[model samples]
Target: MILTRRAMLIGATTTLAGCDRIGSNARFREALFSAENFHKWAQRSLMTRDAMAREFRPDQISPIFRANGTANPNTPEYKALWRGDFADWRLRVDGLVTRPLSLSLAQLHSLPHREQITRHDCVEGWSAIGQWRGVPLKTILDGAGLRSQARYIVFHCADRMGTGRPYYESIDLTDAFHPQTLLAFALNDRPLSVANGAPLRLRVERQLGYKQAKYLMRIEAVQHLSGIGAGKGGYWEDHANYDWYAGI
Candidate 1:
C-alpha cells in the first residue's frame, strides 16, 4: 500500500496504527547524515514501496524544456573548466572498488550507449519528455568492478547551496543497475546544455527527477550513503523533506 504525504499528514486512523510512524522516525535519523541537512526517512515509507517512475514514447518529447537546478556553478574550478569547454573534466569512480576510474567524456562516449525518450517528472508537479543518449549505468558499474559489499551508487555533482559544495545523491543497487538507468551525456538528441547538467547526468528512469542528478562529477560504489553525509541519500532528501526513494 502507498502511504502518500497526504495520508501520512492526516495521520489517518490506519496510518497512526502502522509502519509510517516508524518511517517518520527513521527519516529524522537520516537527516543529520545528509550534506544539505534535511529529513526524509519517513518519506520513503510513506510512498508506495518498490514503485516505478514514469517513462514515455519517443514522440512525446517536449519542444521547449527548461533545465532544472544551477545553470552554472560559480566556482573558479568549474568556471575555468567550463570556459575551457570542460576539456579537463573527468568522471571519478572510486570507493569500495577493485580499480578506481577517472574517465573523460570522450572515454565514456566511446563505450556502448543507448537512446531513449522518457518523461522527467519533477516534485513541484511539472513534467517534460526528452530523448537521452548515453551509456547504461550497468556498463560503467561492470567496468568499475563493484566489490561484493557495495550496495549503493552515489553521484557527486557540481552545484552549491550557501557555502556548501554541490551536493551528492544516491540509489540502491537495484535502481543503479536498472537497464534504463543511463549516464546521460546528451539530451533532446544534442549535448546536454549547461542548464541541463552539462557534460553528464544520471537517468535513473525508475525514480523522480532529483535522482537523475545533474552536472555529475563522480560515481562511487558504496555499501551505504550513511556515513557519506548525514546519510539520507540525497541533497533534497536531507534539506527539503523529499524522499530519497521517490519511486514514481
Candidate 2:
C-alpha cells in the first residue's frame, strides 16, 4: 500500500474538497494541523538524528536529470552573475550567527566535499537519481558560528515565483546539520548549469525535491520562521499549503 505522490495527491484533493465545505469549522482546521504535526513527530521519533537517506550507485544515476521549478532565474542580477561566470557571486551567511560570512564560489570549492547519488522524489510524481557533490551544510554553519538562539536555517534564492515573490525555504536545525545536507555546487561531476541552479543549491536528502532550494543567495539562521514569507517556512508552503516539513 505504498502510494505514489500522484495517488496521494488525488486522494487528498477529493478529501480536501469535502473539507472545504466545512472549512470554517475550527475543530476541523485544528485537527488538520494536528495531523500534519503528528506526521512530522512520528517520522522524527522513528529515525535517529544521524540517520542517512538511501543512496544509489553511480550506475543508477538518471540518464537525464530533469531540472524542476525555475529553470533559470534570468533576473537582471542573476543574469549579470551568470555573464561573469559567477566569479563575483557570494553566498551570504548571516542572521543569528556570531560571525557572518560572505563566501565566494571558489571558497566553497575549496572546502571538504561530499558526493552522493540519491533519488530526488518530486511532489509532481517524478523522481530522478543524480550524483551531487558539494560541501556539507554543517561545515558552513560551523564557520559562521551559529548562535545558540538559532533554530531554523532559511535559504533565500535568486528566483521569484509567478507572483514575483522571492523563492525561499527553511529547515530546522535537525536537518540543517544532517550529514547529507549539502550546499551542492556540482552534479554528475560537472559544474551545475543555469537550468540546474549553478552557483549553489541545497540538498536536504531526507526531504522532497522542493525542499532543495536552488540559486541560493543567502543562508540565514533564525530563531523562528514567523517573519519569513507568509510565515510558512517556504514559498510553496505559503502559496500551495505545502507542509513545512516535507520529509519523504
Query: What is the clash count for each candidate, in the order shown?
Result: 14, 0
Query: For every candidate structure, what is the RMSD over all alpha carbons to the true structure, in angstroms?
Result: 8.3, 5.8
The C-alpha TM-scores of every prediction are 0.78, 0.91
Clashes by residue pair, model 2: none
Whole-model Cα lDDT of every candidate shown, in order: 0.80, 0.94
Distance from true location, Cα of 46 in model 2, Å:
0.8
lDDT value, candidate 1, whole model? 0.80
Candidate 2: C-alpha lDDT: 0.94
lDDT of 1 by residue, 128-190 (tens): 888889999889888889999999999999878554856789988877877788999999888
Residue 69, candidate 1: Cα error in Å is: 1.8
Q: Please provide, for model 2 over 16-47, each residue's C-alpha lDDT reduced to its tens digit, 9 standing for 90 to 100.
A: 98878777688876677677788899999999
